[model samples]
Target: AVVSFTGVAVAVVSFTSIGVAVVSFSDGSVTVVSFSGVPVAVSFSRISVVAVSFNDIAVVVVSFASIGVAVVSFSDGSV
Candidate 1:
């Protein structure tokens, strides 16, 4: 696992053949997971709740999950 902790604001985690996780320290939390340069998922975190979504079609929001493994909603809507 290649972890780059830039600072107290940004953190990046990348693993070959796996997905990447980016954490934002800002009040508004945003997460992005990509595959082959395509953004497949996103998480809009509001406090203790993180809203997972799929492709831009949802831009798409319609699921509830957590930091660990989850049946996350694919941006492509392949939940």
Candidate 2:
């Protein structure tokens, strides 16, 4: 489902099989959220990409006018 609020968007997807969850923005970023699970992506002023590889998952939050990038990752050290 694609939710458009103002000029932003909130896209949500549900899965029933084993797979990977990826999220990408229009700026120039990509992201993966889960493997064989539900994924949620949100966009603001910049593009953010989240990806899930192996048992590891990555999260990134960036701003358009900011100078800082917040990166959070979780994995079993196999990524």
How many residue pairs clash per model? Answer: 4, 9
Model 1's TM-score against the true structure: 0.22
Backbone clash total, candidate 2:
9
Which structure among the candidates has the greatest lDDT?
A: 2
Local accuracy of candidate 2 as per-residue lDDT tens digits, 1-79: 2223344434332222344444444444555455533344455455454433333343222332243434433333221
Give the TM-score of each candidate.
Answer: 0.22, 0.29
Q: Compared with the true structure, what per-residue lDDT tens digits does model 1 show for residues 1-79?
A: 1212333223222222234334343445555544444435443442122233233222222232333322223333244
Off by over 4 Å in 2: 9-17, 36-79
Candidate 1 Cα errors over 4 Å, as ranges:
1-8, 12-17, 37-79
